[model samples]
Target: MNKLMILTGEPLTRSILANFFDGISDFCVEGSFEDVPGLLSAVQNSQVDVLFADAEYAMQGNFLPLINPYGAKRPLIVLLARDGQAAAKSYEMQNVIDYVIKPSTPERLFLSLQKIRMQLSLINSYEAVGAPHSPRRDYVFIKVNKKMVKLSLDEILYVESVKDYIKIVTEKKSFLVYNTLTNFTASLPEGRFARIHRSYTVSVDKIDAIEGNTVEIMTTRLPFSRKYIAENQLKVFK
Candidate 1:
């Protein structure tokens, strides 16, 4: 079972988190605290696997770093908010594992948890597979206008949708390809590329900045669609 510790300032928020995970047999809410001091103490002494926290506390400058010390072995810290806009903004600047918007239904919460679980599993699998000496298999080549181009996996900036076609933007130039964003997405490596918008598939590494639902790739800014918002929390980047 995974042990969890929740930190929220509001009494209602703490209660909601407790009830949300009450039925999950594999998860255990070890404790809930309204202040950062207690939360830090609990985390230091207990085997907490995750921390569901409020963005306000994170913004207030609490023990956020302790929850993710050394950048490894850090407990997944999920931030709770009322909407995706605030969550996206907070996540862009903070190191929270994920975000849960308020008025969040049980189904939404479960799906978020499931996504985190899957990410954790994938990380474990990768570690077990041993680090490959060769380059990461996260890029693909495409034929454009009778020309064969070798695109670097990490150099992809963003993808744009143009009616029936999709344009792939890299560090150097943009390539117009004869494929749907969805179909082209299937050809690229998973985890590394995310469908942030219906018309876009962005390389997680090329993101230079994020504001609201818009992600800045180099000089190009792209919109993040609601359909692919969940992908934003997958930890594909950094």
Candidate 2:
């Protein structure tokens, strides 16, 4: 089970988030704070997996400074904000998986949570073993529903996770494979594809810009985490 810790100043918002997860399975609300007053303590006690915080609260007040300093592995952050579009560029948080706009439904929040769990799984899956695939050209085969199809690597702009499945997004089309990013990546040539973030992987040829931790690929902004950046750097237009 993933331990969830929430940091929000709004009591009503905090209660809503806490109550929502209580009804869900495999997750327990470890702690919900009015501020970052006991952030480290809660993390110490429960070993929080993901953090849901309010951007508006953090910006004005001295809430917890985004990342968990004492943690061996920093908890993944999911920023909750009203103006997510505006906050996207503002936050640019490497640890933050995604930003959920305010008044978001459980469906939307769970979708992001699924991606987060898959992401953590992917990283752990690859950490111990070497990937068997080498950079291949021409065509690649991917799982689509119960059928298998060949997709040209050049046509693919990026890939994102949706629940237990992965979405292969191409220039003109998109397809979902009932697979994890760890498995879905086996179809791609490592030399050409970059794991921009946990929930995202993009073709290097498709990247438009790299500003701080964010990568703009084909009109979409994706993030790369701090851990990966130190070892591998992606090619960016500017």
Candidate 3:
């Protein structure tokens, strides 16, 4: 289980977060603080894997200056703010994983927890192997219905983004995954996929034709955004 800490200046907010995490099996709340010094001290004394902090306090206060001195020992941060105003600035910190808006719900927090798990998994894998693991096989494991589903890379034709989810299209059917287009694309083999639009990513080798702004895969033609024209170096565009 990953140890988590909550650092917000409001006692009510801290209590709510701590109580919400009580039932979660994968994470344990080490402590919750209404001040930076208390949080910093706890961080120094405990083994914390994740820290959910108020975004304003993290950015505008003396919190970062004191905490950053810990360097590699600093726990991963998830900033909580009323709006996205502090998101860009807070993300500059390497340890920050997610920035959530206030009045956080279980669903939103679940997504943030998923990101934290993925980051921790990557870090652990790299530390154990001394390098990033490259895919040796053509298949990748995707989470579906609370289980891991092994999917072949070649089985993917294209991916469509729908709001907070992505649809992975294959020959027979498509799977709806609770993931952003950006995160889903990063999980796939890098060179094999081309992001042709903000909402669409296609398999490079599966391209049947490209006429104007449309890319044809099998009998289906998908529109490509001109914004990616310069970024696309596929000879098919020639």
How high is each candidate's TM-score? Answer: 0.51, 0.48, 0.51
In angstroms, the error of model 2 at 116 is 1.6
Candidate that scores best on lDDT:
3
**Model 1 pairs in collision:** 81-102
lDDT (Cα, tens digit) per residue for candidate 3, span 70-171: 234236788988888766555544467688888888888889878888878876764567434653546655545534466898999999998756788999
For candidate 3, the lDDT comes to: 0.76
The candidate, 1 or 3, that scores higher on lDDT is 3
lDDT of 3 at 29: 96
* Candidate 2 residue-pair clash tally: 0
- Model 1 spans > 4 angstroms off: 93-97, 130-238
Against the true structure, candidate 1 reaches a TM-score of 0.51
Candidate 3 C-alpha error for residue 101, in Å: 0.7
Candidate 3, position 20, lDDT: 80
What is the RMSD, in Å, between candidate 1 and the native fold over all Cα?
A: 14.5
Error of 3 at 157 (Å): 43
Candidate 2, position 18, lDDT: 88
